[model samples]
Target: MKNLLKNGLMLLTGILMLATSCNQISDSESGGNGKIVLSLTDAPFPVSLVDKALVTIDKIEIRSTATVSSTTEVTTNSELFTVLYDGDPMEFDLLDLQNGITTELLSMDIAAGSYDLIRMHVTNASVLLKDGSNFDLKVPSGFASGLKIKMTPNLVIESGVESEVILDFDVSKSFVVQGNMKAKNGIKGFIFKPVLRATCQKYSGSVGGKVFENATTPIAEAHVQIIAADTILSSALTDAAGNYHMIGLPTGSYKVVCEKDGYTPVTVDPVVVKAREKTTLDIQMATATVTVNP
Candidate 1:
């Protein structure tokens, strides 16, 4: 698979849809085809041993919902259009594209309508250990079917309007190891189970704050999660100062959860993040009571 992406014949056949473009059009220009753009972003996945998580994406697909009053639309599940991302397959380190940075996936003109689904083809995934060793991040299945990420709110492409969607690739939750730890590769090997969410810049916000064991002790390496509607939006690891931040969350009511080894977990509920804004939620973990047998 590595050879297929790196030096394969993909370049000759790879369709170049749209390059990095900052496109804007007036309400008048938004007809015929609406400009659609996609950017790749990631959420935190904290691990001690794994140094780098490199993932490769080959193609992108889209299925639209008919919103135009006059035009006919396809509502069938099998109806999918390949959004052109013409280029050599790109390998990205999930850890690097965090906080705020992102890479453009594609920008092209598509028939104006509302899109219900966006799928990404992750051709390959591999990890680099801290010790400079590397291995293929095995995928049990789903690559052929594509990583199906549902746009909770349908993505509308108005005539002459520019629409953009950001894929919040959660690396921490996406990659999983199965089976017994007693084995060599851990769970049948490193499985790339992708976890992703679609959010638009117009509707997303960020969450950040410091965590504490109490009023005095800062909690480092704490797992901080931001969840909305029972779904985890993003997660981060508290730094040395117990500071953590989760970005690219679709604006909504959410809860912040803080957890660490040997400490009691805490959740701060009713934390609201407005569009294009940041919400701060501080947390404190009570120590777990220890039982001793004399």
Candidate 2:
């Protein structure tokens, strides 16, 4: 009788252990979703000429490939696309977001998986010049279809993790000048062709510092660029405070150059950057000397 009781207890214990293991497996597979924190940033714009650059975004969407149960409806574009945000249109001045600064656009919970692309719908765009003149910028196809940007390295969201994504608007490249800046009526107008890039914060690094002519004199409106293999990776202009910042760089060594109209350009090579790290590099430039003919 004692043997029978002992065997029964053992069987019950084994069953309970098995049930606990099964529950753990279920939780690990589908316990919860991940989160995404989206933000906007801009490369240095020519603040000396352009006073303000504005853009209004109405909707945002993401493309994922993970086979998870979702309530997202199949859009005409693709079934793998999901609407991350669709609400009030938010307008932002690109000039205000620079020098390592950013403005949060949206934040939401997303399924744990891999996302490859992001599309942003732009409703309005305009530019104001320092001369008190403004013009409504035209957005070709972006008004209807949205501006599509592919992720450089595919974004991976793990269960219960919060990921940060930054959308960088390149102002200098997007706005093409129609006329010469020095000639009267030289500045006819500008054509708007939106150029944007996306980066994941966890896998990228940043570099920033002050550009100066001397220890106390800051050089404003100076161009700072990062170069690799004779190509420019990214660039920024010094603010009034002589500060410039370049973000979303992959982990590697880069050559940095700082130049202005009147000052001699300075170059620093092999500046190493690591993931999630910020490298500080302050540069001092001297005035360019002109050669006089005898």
Summarize candidate 1's per-residue lDDT along 1-294 as a digit string, tens digits: 100001011110011111111223344534488677676666665455568888887766777554323344332344455465635777778766654456765567888766666656677888776767677866546346556665656666777766666666667656665455445664344566676666655556778888887777998878887765676656777767888776657666888777777898888888888776878777878888889999
Collision count of model 2: 0
Q: Model 2, range 18-129, lDDT digits (tens) per residue? A: 0000001122454368787776777676676778888887778888745324664423365567887779987888888777667777677888777666667778788899
Number of the top-ranking candidate, with TM-score as the measure? 2
What are the lDDT figures for the candidates, one per model? Answer: 0.62, 0.69
The TM-score of predicted model 1 comes to: 0.74
Candidate RMSDs in order = 7.9, 16.7
What TM-score fits each model? 0.74, 0.83
